[model samples]
Target: MKRLQQLIRYSTFALGLILACSFISERNQAGAVERPWKVRAYIQKHDFLAEALRQETGIPKAIIYAVAGLESDWGRSELAKNANNHFGIKSKPEWRGLEYCKPTQEYNGQQMVTQNDCFRKYPLIRRSYEDFGDFLMQSERYAILKTLEANDYTGWTDAIQNGGYATDPEYAHKLRGIIWRYQLTKLP
Candidate 1:
């Protein structure tokens, strides 16, 4: 009888451990929605950024898609949901010297509400793309990018990751993978 009781106790403990591990695994994988990089989304949502990218960086549409895909998986990123904060610009609370203003329904495009908060909104993806480009141009962090501006999307990406835009350990690797996957360097 003692041996049987011990066996049952061990079995229950093992079952509980398995259950806990399964729960954790499921939680970790849950809510991971993949957003495919689409040119149209960029055209509609980030048109302003898109144009600026072309004009300033001379990078084509395809390259932008590849870069954004690796960065935020085409803007379906978890962080993107909050304040449309792609490119992971950290809050500069010290820059609170900037003015604050309320947004109106008609006030479209990216606007800085407070020194620390910026909202990027667009009626279409193209607008979003262009606005994103302009965003980097205007931001203090990427100001150096403007000066060294060339069509070096690869270099731009590396600089962005190195500049502490994101804490992701594999950010640069993932970005490179996406860039290679789509061969954005060749697309006109």
Candidate 2:
């Protein structure tokens, strides 16, 4: 009986270790750096483009910056590097542009689900930022964001999550963490 309990405990520990390693490995494989400063530098380098988009579209650059950082690791991920898709905006059936498909993890209300999703592809990095702003501006699901005050990164973050821009329940929190961690709100 003692041996049976020991076996069960060992099995549980092994399963948990495996799952944790897989999760971290996948995140690392996505090209995110382990250091926070790298993300800040990356965001700074790309802020010019996101700032331009903000000016043209009235979307907060901070939100754009954080989402792009989280989704594509500031343009280092395979999807972003190969296809210029930094925002991870999936392709809809109506999409007529190029597409890139990859395995991604999404939340389906109750749990994390991994599936191959088709992402919108752009020919240029600037185009990707432009399309990302346009997506939030034109979609009714994100209409509420347009009404929020400019520079309200928190509000923008919340609305983006509630609008289903991402499936993770903690999507907004993660965005906010990055924004706060790197002082992204300091951006003018």
Candidate 3:
């Protein structure tokens, strides 16, 4: 009878542990669910500028939005907040504009390494979007992306990734996912 009581107590403890773990998992999932709403809000706030830039530069608005969204963490990154640099455009030696220096992580073929990098700082968010368009237009490496249809965000993402816009091997995949998940292609 005593052994039976001990077994029941152990089972109760295990059950409580399982319930706690399940609750924690649900909380994490809830945060994931909330992220889409945040991204959507970001898109809504910036879609007009993205569309304007797209019309001016012929770069797809979806590509612009997705790249900015990913690079800037939906405009919540320190670079975006402080520098208005939504595209993560690093400072070049020839850059004659203000720069913000910060520690950033870059994949070094083997692993991500943190390094101090200087990024362009913009007086206005519009300037940041415009500079991103200019960067793509002027870079010979991304010239292939310009020939694709304006609505072909997938092709553009693939070309941008191929053009070494990011070190992440899954950069195109993530951009495509963001475009699809948020229906960015439908934006004007």
Candidate 1 off by > 4 Å: 1-52, 56-63, 75-119, 147-153
Estimate the lDDT of model 3. 0.89
- For residues 1-188, write the lDDT of model 2, one tens digit per residue: 99999999999999999999999899878854454676767776888998899889888767888899999987789999988999999999978999999899999996999999999999999889989988999999999987999878788899999999999999999999988776666676
Worst 10-residue lDDT window, candidate 2: 31-40
TM-score comparison, 1 vs 2, better candidate? 2
Note the Cα lDDT for every prediction shown.
0.55, 0.87, 0.89
Rank by TM-score, descending?
Answer: 3, 2, 1
What value does the lDDT take at residue 93 in candidate 2? 91
TM-score of decoy 2: 0.78
C-alpha TM-score for every candidate: 0.45, 0.78, 0.78
lDDT of 1 by residue, 1-188 (tens): 99999999999999999999898778658833233446447435765665567777554554466556654556776545544544433335433322223222221233323233344433344444555565555668766665554556667767666765555555556666766665555443
- RMSD per candidate (Å) reads 12.1, 11.4, 6.5
Tens digit of lDDT per residue, candidate 3, span 12-71?
Answer: 999999999999789867753334777878877998898888889899888998899999
Q: Give me the runs in candidate 3 sitting further than 4 Å from their true place.
A: 1-35
Report the Cα lDDT for candidate 2: 0.87
How big is the positional error of residue 119 in model 2, measured in Å on the Cα after superposition?
A: 0.3
